[model samples]
Target: METGAEVSGQAGLAPYPVVEEVSSLLNRPADEIDASVSLGERADFSTRVSELNAKSAAGDPAAFYGQQLLLSRIYGLVTQLPEGPTAEGSIVVQEVLRQLEQATIAAEDGMLESGILDAAPAEPTAFLSWLKKLAKEHRVYKHPYYREFIRDQATADDLRHYVIQESVVDGRFDDLLAMMQVGTSGAAKMEIAENFWDEMGNGDPSQVHTHLFNQIYEVFDISPDELERSLTANALLSGNLAVLLCRYRNLYAEAVGFLGMTEWLAPDRFVQVVHAWDRLGLPDIGIVYHKLHITVDSRHAAGWFHNVVVPAAESERMRRAIARGTLWRLNSSARYLDERMPELASHR
Candidate 1:
């Protein structure tokens, strides 16, 4: 839960990488932390660090931010914490994530500068069609990471690693869906509400998606200690970005796009994951989430396009926000898959 930046280096050999100029792989930031001076030494390091994100956009940029945001702390910081004075440490961490989010959108510098998502079709149905087409053809479906790191190529531990990393996002999905419901109404509200209901297992506590996800953790014997070690920079960013999009109202439309894209992406990916689970000989109880989602998400994606995206596309502002959110998900997801490959390679 404390996988984010605030405590990333707390028990590790170093503080989070100091905005390094080079990484072990190619030209990305270097993967070194500082133990001599912990990330807790915020005041000491504050002078050199940027008030904005060290990286610019969703891929590496978001991944770095994710390394800092502890999942346990973020829930309280973003939603439950009442109006009150906040610590400077919390302030700095939140600012970094905020800036990273802004930079993600600002990189496009407005949707119009990029492509049609910036300018949606006047007719909502046409816009809906475009979103579906985008989902069908997006580059992430073709990502090398997915190809190299799939069921047939996996070991049992490799399969567990995939599940553990994915749990970063899968673990918190219902809450994210709940966040999207704020200030929403009409078909969009109904759609999200229904989706959330499904996530809740339609009033069956035994069937709640989160409960279902926990089953895998149970099967893997993934204790609290193992969970943190299992998290990677890429997985962290993927989870953090989802939290960032859903927590703030200004990012609401972006959340719609992001969540919608997730619905679009999940079913197919889950299908493969089910294969991986089976191939790895994992227990049936551990894989209910993937098996269920293989069908559920397809239905959710269709309804999302019809009820949520189509209704929201009525306004230009909403259209662009949705586009950015969707693309942000795609970009971060691709980065996550790519970055996670090397982790899997070692397991193989």
Candidate 2:
């Protein structure tokens, strides 16, 4: 719950000289530099750096940005090493330089974003309203790709591909819920745990959402092994990566935004998808997952928006992060559907 500053405290870990240089280069204050590099005391510096590296390797946009910032700071330090610093510099300095080189290479290979730190913030209400408008206007249910699939334009193989890809994505639901639970307290923690409980069926084996979803796949003859082995689509992968970036970075407002939009939009989106399954004459057992989301997600969405996003997003940066998370979800889904639409038409 604490900001990186609050958890790590202002004392003790003074900014390294290179970090200060980076701060000056970026026109940011020393404290901001410290926070950027500190990333809070929740994990050691190396471990956090490693995690960021992994996310960058996986193509997470935010993580890529963070990696750039981190590497720039380290590079600044490398530049400050003693003039005698040849390839034969102190082992410590050499190792730092080695890491800096690797990170720079990675950044060059990965997606690049400029001025991320300078992104203008927005008021929470305006940001949330923008997200709602975006969602309403670009609703996945309204997408032609989905409509075509629902209209029986897609072959059984196409439908099976979709089901498998989605089931693989759904398998991450519990993990996402658990990740969002971190750094929360009191009512927030309680609500999140309740959501987790609902997801896991309050510890009852039969009612678990994942199990219910698995049953739906079974009706399609998509064996659990098949679902597990399915390749993740890029859009789904990016969307999940965005959520994980927010969680790992402890970006609380972004996490709230991501979760809130997901809950709010699930029912609206799933309603059509579920109807499509029925139109295809799939068994009722295979449709419960969609039915369950339509019934439960509205309440979850409202609760999250009022209790979490509204209360937590007090700053422009936080609000902007929230907006980014929401848009990331919407846009990614849109892209996913668009890419798959042609497959259905081609099948026809």
Candidate 3:
């Protein structure tokens, strides 16, 4: 079976009159024939889609750029396609989705490297200074997030296998219920629907699933094992700031200041835990970071900003405070990483 890329490329492979013959069959103008066949200088949009999907599965920034541009053009084409809701349009949509899955998978895998969470602790006052520097960066970053969404490598090789995992909680409960209605047991269906409803209702964080909740603390530690497993095994992992930054490098530096600061400072208390564990002469005993970045500093920093900054931010003074807070966040992350992964400084 020819992939979309193959079909798209051959769309223009024949002579102009031959191409006109194909266009006439579809009731499209000759210009449409040329443009669709050309698919742009970098091969047709479909080829770019295939390439972008492949690259994104590996967390490459360039793939993100190309994919975004390709999607924009294809979305326009999708609207104007002669068979808007037929097999042809569905094929293109499926191909686009295949590529998106690849990119998202790559990003999740990239997060698994120890470096993403690697950081060393700094002295209190010095850490404060670091935050000041980073906040300055976040204030000016501007990359929009909602553009060019897709699922690249969803199934093993099947293109139309629902590449991205859809959350039934996103106002799609009835649709899912319809699927379960076919011939499944009423008891099982009701049980699943109730669980879904519970997720949608989120009354308290602690009451959430334990496995779901504890992983929050693991990322603040030195082990990337959980992240590694997640990247390799799952395709519907929740999105985070770091993954978003990797995809949108244009906003990478600025956008991460706030999250970086929170990650850097949120686990301060955890640092104290390391110290206490050491003082008590306890064994390393699952202690990922002894005197370092693993702990509650990032949590505290996140709390302080969310609780203090968002509620009180109104005037120039508040704006300055927010800036100060974000800088402290970003600078601290860089400092922590600089100490933990000095090799990265060359990139800086």
Top of the candidates by lDDT: 1
lDDT of 1 at 236: 63
* lDDT of each residue in 1-348, candidate 2, tens digit only: 101221011122222333233334333333444445543331344445555566656755444444443343333332224333232222332343345346533443243235432343355555556667767876453666655454456555666777776753464566567776887887778777878888897798888888888886677787745543343333334434434444454556566766777788777667767767777787788778779888778888877776667655566667666766665566556656765665553443
* Comparing 1 and 2 on TM-score, the stronger one: 1
- Evaluated at residue 343, the lDDT of candidate 1 is 66
Q: Model 2 off-target regions past 4 Å?
A: 1-123, 139-141, 235-243, 246-249, 343-348
lDDT at residue 225 of model 1 (Cα atoms):
68
List the candidate numbers ranked by TM-score, top first: 1, 2, 3
TM-score of 2: 0.61
Pairwise TM-score winner, candidates 1 and 3? 1
Steric collisions counted per model: 11, 0, 38
* Each model's lDDT: 0.66, 0.56, 0.33
Backbone clashes (count) for model 2: 0
| Candidate 3: Cα lDDT at 21 | 24
- RMSD after Cα superposition, model 1: 8.4
